[model samples]
Target chain A: MEQPEEVPHNPTEQAAICFKAFMLKNSPKSNLNLYDHLVRVLCKVMDERPENAVDVIEDLSLEVKRTGMRDKQSTLRDTPPVPAVQLLAEQQKTLFTRGSGDDVEPEEELVETPLPNLAEQSFYLEQAGVGLPREELQRIHLALKQLVDAQPLQTCRFWGKILGTQANYLVAEVDFREGEEEDEEGLQEDGADEEEKEGGAGDEDEEEATEEIDPLPVSAYKPPPAVPKEENHTGVNKFTYFVCREPGLPWVRLPPVTPAQITAARQIRRFFTGNLDAPIISYPPFPGNETNYLRALVARISAGTQVSPLGFYQFGEEEGEEEEEAARDSFEENPEFEGVPVPEMVDSMANWVHHVQHILQQGRCVWVNLAEKPEEDLEEEGDEEEGEEEPDEPEPEVGPPLLTPLSEDADIEGTPPWSCKMSSTLIPQFAIAVLRSNLWPGAYAYATGNRKFENIYIGWGMKFVGEGYTPPMPPAPQREYPSGEEITEALDPSLEEEQALQAALEERRAAEEEAEELEGEEEEEEEDDY
Target chain B: MGVTEDELKDKKALYSLNCIDWHLLPLPTPVLLAEVAAVAKGRFVGDPSFEYELTETRQQGEGDEAVKEEFTMKVTEEKRLAATVFNIEKDVSVVPRGAFIRTPHDTVQVNHSFQGLSTLEARNLGNYLHFTEPQQLKKKSILEMADLDPSIDFLDPLSEDILKGSWSLQMEGSSMCVLRSLLWLGLTFFHVPATPQHGYIYMGDGLKNLDLPFML
Candidate 1:
């Protein structure tokens, strides 16, 4: 048989394929350690390649500079730098072209001339800006080392936090035990040393006594036994577990908390009150203000998921259908369509109601008081009329209508006359809860559409009761003007009172005019004399 | 009436700002020019009592290759108002290709080259040319040229528009300081819009009406 045909081995092609495969496998882990390794390997490879290496280095340097600048601006400030691909390309080119001495020499010289300075400057700038200070860098390095070493343990805690399980408790217990043993050893040494000195024991005897009482055994002195793991105290663990591990979902790991996160959570909590289990509907907070912290929290919580508490009234087919049906029913029920422009009246009433509700929600009682004053006046007028006709004295009522009774007809406005006091008593608890929780600033389903109007009525009622008054009715439009004689007759008594007041005002005005005239005349005389 | 050279130069400058290139107008024929010359010289050209029809034509082709059409002029003399009407046998272009028009204060160029011309352009041009005289061409509108140059004196009424529109006045001589002041003004007054066309134009005053003379 002929000698086996020798196969040509293309190392460059093989390396290229291997590199591609490696990148494909590990590119997703763009974290710091892998990034550093890539950078170092690429640098080493480029150092061997002399030709086409300068361009690669320059491109890499530019990339590093760009990343350094971006890292400064990025919110995730501690993210590690990723080495430039150009650097790796340069290394590959250098490695492939290493045998060509003539091409490599000039390129090497060029790379050598500026490489150090560019690298130094880039390093200095990065360190000055985004890179941590020496102390911080040391701390980070140590922390990273610890993290790597204790990754298994940390992973357990992380999973435990997410799963709302007892993993964290078990870890805490283990740590507690180790701490107690160390403390016991320290205590025994201190106590035994003092006792031996007080007894003035010989050195050998002291040594013997020390040997007899083992320091390790002192650690066995256990305090009162810890509560059993199965025992539930205050149900805090159960609550945390429920919040962490709800059905049909994996536990989510929380990102490191920042000041912004804290503020956002607080704001969201303040608005939501009914039940923890209830879905939350969050509204975009006021723009250009710190109030967006609440919105940001809601955004974070709702991130990676579509579940939101504030999703009840999102514009959709169902909502539109309901609105249409309601409109139809309202129209059919209304009998008086002869002359009244129902739509305009309804719009105005809705607007008025909304205004009242907004004021109440804002905790502004003054506006409610203003609105109710007219109603109170009308009620008082009616009461006066009744009293005059009956000629009977009646005791004034003590307290305004209680809010609890108002809830029965809360949805309707014209059912019966009631004080705001009743409505407040009924809804105060819910309102207070809303105010305290993080949910107050955002949109809510109950606060939308006709519900807003209902809230306004409630607010108006609250103000009415608070101020102890009802709003007066508007006067009817005048059909015609009175004749001159009739007007004179109607105004006679009022005109007499007005005449007296006018005469006094006129006398005062006359005195003032005379004084002014005298002053003017005197000024003219002075001018003439001059 | 014949216009002086100075009047022509002033008109040229006004036309330049309005982007009107006047050199493109078609030259009148020798016979038509003779009639115009006779009329201008006050001689009984063709028929003083008997009416001779005058025609105007406008074409849209390039250079000397453009075509022309004829039209008739109906002239009426009244003590109340002077009126002239042109009757066209063929379509006579009402708007010239590059006639300078004025609206309120600013000049606008009439571009008949555009597929369809707005009537507003014709009305504006008529208003401006009707009101303006050759002598008044050099006199600029107080509001129009106010913010164009900053070297104007504040005390001068001619510079009132500039002064009013001036967003800043800094101590003279320092370029850096001036730049900083400008930067401050840019940050404070500039409204960076999501779209280029919708970007906010600071009108100096609080007025937001588009009809206002001010534009960025």
Candidate 2:
């Protein structure tokens, strides 16, 4: 609202101009930059029209002051957050502490897990022309004994070697003592405490500053279809694993595997270098270190290849009908299983069946979360795009049932994954029957005429893909520009369309001439007035 | 009586008995008997039985015209065990390079000067040959046999077994060399590092592993 004859002057704008001039003339050269910054900040405040402009400017000023003084005050503040190396070291300390139990009974050891006679087993293995060298076998046996005594384990079995570039990992699979769930809970609490300490150290002051204004509650990003605890004596998560570079070295227990990790591991093919902490720099990068990957792989190999003679084991009794109805179905050794003849076993692939439950596409032997979560939650989290499951949906495909014959499972290439053989052709009755997995090379199982069988794997864990193992190649780089159909001028245009284009062009030119003529006349009139 | 000197002289002829020295070259029959006795002692609870028979019953022609013929082959437990040992040895028994050689008279004899295989040669299954006769040399073309040593190559190499990777050669205790056969489960061949000390034994049941080809 300016009056016709009055000169408009905003006091604040005038004042800002005056202040800038005064500062330039009066302030020392050293402080000139700071003064100019102050002027700019004020100018920003006046130029922007925000609802809470005063409060916003006040925040901006305080932020500027804090940044200006940051260098001087940095030394006064507490040391920065704990580095990744220290955190890793702390984690490793906890792992070792957890594995090494102080008290293990000596007299009651015999009644503990019945350890396989390594020397006797080696003798048979050598006869069949499989297994590690005698010296290696002896070392492994002794080391495993030492491990059993050191850890509070119910049972321990040597789970063969996984060949690595630098060194091989001698894995020992062990089950926890009965009712050891309390110790696991304690371990989890310790982990939680450590996490709280880390969180408190890094952002305690910031949290205090905004205490009155509650922070937004952020829901953690949980990987879908979380792996359930293995409460039974079967499946991938039933046992823990400890691995070492050499037999005599200290055993490092690998972290329990997650279904997500196993699923990711299935997509990658990498050689272990016997280092647990080594990074897996791969496409769709692995979630954890080699230790976790090794655990997942061990689980996979167990589910895929661990097998026994048919009728050797029967489905274990499902305990507790109510509440635990969806419990994992397990297998137990059949007391009445009489040994099959070696000739009969060697004659066909049907005699051999996987005793371990089959691993479903979801990387677990059993899908246990069926009755727990609502159908909607399951659908949202499940990897499959299973269309809106109804409340009464049929049981999802878990996989072929436990103890399915080896012959029933075909290799990806349509060839039988297993090859059955008798130990000796000269003496059919006395010879043992052997089954070797062609799908996963280096996995072999042998059974004697009587009730005795064992499965062992010794290879650079890789699936046989017909040819030599090759790391999958990265996808080809995307083309920068999309290709389009080539346009040629050979085709003639219709007469009507051509005439329309010509008329539109002529009309546009005439309009341009008219505007130009009007502008030239206005210029002439202005010149006459001058 | 008065007789011609030439005729009378021949009448004083003498005969001398000649026997094979069992110490130098042990009689195979007795050794075979000992093996059977050991096996029979275990099977029959210290009663070395002399009777074990394998009966073969064949029915000829269709159901209506079928003539049931029963053939009873009378065999002792000893003979059966000996036959089994012979069968296993025929297929899987192996010897290191130069351990045996072909004589000019077309016979294979132990090479006394073989000083055992070198460590490098010991590692490879190709350096060991089946103790039995060489079927491969006879089948090889003249061009393929050009580089083969007739004296040493008179037997097929263990590497030439029908199923490749059936033979596993390894060093035990870094001193004693051992070769095991996957096909013949209990067949084990041991050789001292560097001496004319090598031997093979098949202690498995009397059966041939026909499934080896599939395993490989």
Candidate 3:
């Protein structure tokens, strides 16, 4: 990893330097050029910290250098190491002494949180962006041609957009309000011209020229009407574009007055505090993402603290089964002979693991809704003035409001008053991408993407998806993996041999202690004789 | 994959990234937690595209003021990953002019021209690139999946350190297509056969045509 004396002033230059180094080191004489990589690194950086472009780019290069180019090639999923990171068995208290308990982290372990992936950086960029130099803009546009190369994923915007609120937001399009200035200038100007002409011009000539009554005054090109100044202080801005091959980069992010999002974020925090017992909905591809998101809001009430009477245990399976024993028992079960189909066994096992993830510790797997448009967008279109500029024109086409979708998604109709909602597409829209980028890395670790010290043994299981009362799986069975000895026994012989050798080496240290003791005793005798 | 780590490591963990085989995914383990991450697979037709549909369904749940207040069946969801295949035009030049599309993951392509089909000719509307195409994934068998099979020794079952895989695929063969379909256009590592023995695959327009006949 190259260390920067200080972060370079020009991000593109630094990106160019790293990009060249990266290409030479990674793909010399290959098709991917320095410009291509520089753009991705730069755009991703600028999006996350628009104002801090220099810092972002420097941090990015630093990240690239420090982590090595090899690391970026893979997914951001953090593992609890090969032993499929199990939640560390916790004790009442931890010791500070060297190597005392499960709490003692190994010196070599890289317990690092992943920097946002290209996808996440792009997603955040979608909601927000930083202004860029025009030269960089040209570079991005030219790179757009190159961005179309074959890719697994590519960045794009969500269709149903929310216009804006108090926070900073990207100007997606011109927002058309209901009322117009009503051609007051044209009417007033024409009247003044008529009065002046009535005195000077003859009636016959005036009548002949009437055919050309209101030739629009060739006044200087008037910039389009201004948006209500009270809404946002920042003037109209241009969006940042990057070369795209496939997905991973977010186009931009919107900052709206999403109190529910904030409330949900708070609820998420409280869920960790053991304040909410809202059952975690499964990850994506399951059904009912609404439930997952709505429950996110109800972790507690803001007015006063009222923890849900129901905790994680309510959603769990029958009690009395130990996690380790259950895991072992399930692991040992040859489901093929046990009368279950492989797929069924797989589902059952997945469910069991899912249950173990949810019950034994805090559940991290969250349901995030991917995109689908909402009604307000259509309504807002109707509300747009007919006199407004053409729809197809890129000139200032702002989007609709934010709150409706959240309230729509979160609405409660049939349920008793105790229930919250999972109605809005917004819940899934903003949250899903962020969740995937954030928690995906730790999904497999035993702590399921949590820290050992936090004792928050949890990680995302599966995101809830689909559109039905998909019959909930028979509650998850208790789960465990083979014990340390058993898990290790299945490992390489060299590892065991290494273990034995280390044990032997530790025991051998006693000889040195014994030798020193004998020498001291002999010395004492010699002194007595003297 | 050749696209290295986004999550920068502290100087301490740099060694893990430096080592070619050490990776953070699949949570490397000795005893195969074969069940944790299994390979799943499916097939695509001759063309490089799929049909997209947005379907809606209603789910009724009893809860507080919010639960019953919202949702008329779930609004606008995908019933399947892909409902139809959007064929790209055969002409290489038309690719950037055709349509915008994406994979199940957020991987997106603008003005994507797949090998052409007449059914979609009339519908080549350039206006709609915003809604990223949702993906279609089947309950693919572990054997059918891409990276999982290459590195894993299911037959012997975790005899060695769990074999890790980067996005390594052969460039000159049809394996690229099959692999490309699976991986979309993420960064990948390829094993170069020469003395030094390392190569990489990234999404690039320059190398669009390579070994074609060998793909599955």
Candidate 4:
């Protein structure tokens, strides 16, 4: 906790020890610094392996006599020294010591005092910039205060991403279950209660009650909703499952953002790029981007569920404590699917009718597309997805896929380090089987005291919701989509072409009607003006 | 200091693209010459009532990757109509022959408002210089450098605290442009007990960051 145990008495050794302390978070030393090659290598070694840097530095100083790698002009003075060990035993101990039963890790006060803490309250209340004065600040604060009174800031915003967007159709939630560490949270709450009492706050009973309760165990972190045995209508409970990253806050999970919502989020981001300050408004009877294709495919797999319902089922065993016990007992693999199954590419093509019905059902949100009797005209809207300009000249029955996948899902992803082996082209029949598979080993949440990390177990099998993340009704694996048409109808002609023709005709009819109405209005206006 | 009126004029705040609650049909590729006229009926792109004729797709990337097309995209715009009627009236980006195909009656101006991250000041790392609020040596460092806007006040981003895990990683650009501002923009995940996923702020003038498809 204090300084290292053995502070070397010699000046050179002391300098070496101090250098190692800063080395961990510093950039590596350059090789071209030393004039001689042999001495440079020794200095490099000393610089790299800090613990025994002294001994290595000493040995190299003598050995410069044999090897010719050293520059001829360099001398013993050029060789930097090192300490005798691998790493300081005490320093190593500090790094490894578990947050000592508390959530606080080895937090050395590297800086005795923090710089002026930035104001935590919203800057909307601040009086700064070119012309505003204290009077303006006070007036604006008072006016806004009258509106909100004493209510805490209701941080309203959505965090969403399209799942199965990866080539392999794998989806990952960055901060899956970030509930505070077990008793550590409870212990902190107890400390807060004491502070409240000192401040003469009178909620002692509530504070006492909170202090008495132990923090929920880490295992108790609710996993993704398990496969829903109970049907989840998009309108009622679908958003509860959306996993998104907050604007700034990382761990807090907002309601589940639909694939359509993710697509919307992207468009919205770009829309605002030009118009930085505009209120979110509504216009079309739309669902989302071209997400229907994937959702349709998922629709087939989900046993005709209108939407690719995430709540429908769990992929494998919940990676809870009990599953770990079962994992030790079994070693066989499920060879059904090559990789895990998830809802991927759900954004490219979407089922607007199905998606909109859900949006309409969730009445009070900003993103609702109010259409007239939307459910009744569902069949009509499906045709809208097809672009109006259908090529009159028919091509072969199975032609090249229409929306040339701008690039492979992986190609688009550019193979970052976090990527695991997955597929852009999925196996449908095997996907169903994969979705039913258990949690793979490497993908479980890892939280030790204050340290928290979770990697969704990526595997060669398809992923399904375990019981924990599943909704009310646990998943009973359903039948797969009957048509073997992922590549055929989704990419190629026929479905979209036929729909496009229908849409073109419909557009013509609507245009004619609008034209006639405009003519009538213009004529009447002209007569009135005369 | 009082907020300048010009900052108010210049500061465009677009909050949500979800404003169009219903999705529009995917922007029709160059095909639909007839349909384009119909939608553009006396409006922005097709207001002149130009004869609708199918033309070959313009801007076709040559070679193996060129998309096989059913209809051509190059439409003779009756005239770009000054590109002003659609509220892109001021400081609109002009093209040396604009690429995004536009018909005179094209009513819907391609407007996107992805409220990008607030002002971030990054200096060339070689000299270990980090620009602050005022951008001058002392003033910016003294005053907490913040891109203050009332709209983003609700979403309080702790940009002033560099050590608070909200700093972006300086990575090589994704080849989005020939001329990069040489500045990387991205959102950072705060150092909380249970969270770790931050991403580059890749939304801006195409020159800033390439539109990479993957979510990091």
Query: TM-scores of the models, in the given order?
Result: 0.14, 0.46, 0.15, 0.19
Alpha carbon lDDT at A184, candidate 2: 61
Q: Return the lDDT, model 3, position A299.
A: 20
lDDT tens digits, residues B141-207, model 1? 7785575332211112211222222222211111111100111111111111111111112111111
Which should have the higher lDDT, number 1 or number 4? 4
lDDT of 1 by residue, A1-530 (tens): 22223332677766766665565464443433434545754775576664676567666655654564576565765665543333433433432232344365777644432111222222332322212234323322332222222222211111111100011000010111122222443464467467646754554465567788874332323232111111111111111111121111122221212233333233332221212233333322222222222222322221111111121112334444676332111111112213212232222222111110111111111112233343454485475443433223334222211111212223212222221111122343322111000111111111111121111000000001111122234556656555687466553558788799778866865786677865566555544753
User: What ranking emerges by lDDT with the best candidate at the front?
Assistant: 2, 4, 1, 3
Compare the candidates by TM-score and give the number of the best one.
2
Question: lDDT at A93 for candidate 2?
Answer: 45
What fraction of the reference interface contacts is present in each model, in order? 0.00, 0.00, 0.00, 0.00
* Model 2 ranges off by over 4 Å: A1-108, A111-113, A181-234, A319-328, A368-395, A467-530, B1-216
Measured on C-alpha atoms, candidate 1 has an lDDT of 0.26
User: Please, what are the lDDT tens digits per residue for candidate 4 over residues B122-153?
Assistant: 11111111211112323343244354322222
Tens digits of per-residue lDDT, candidate 2, A75-122, equal 767788874335534533433342333346545755654465777767
Give the TM-score (vs. native) of candidate 4.
Answer: 0.19
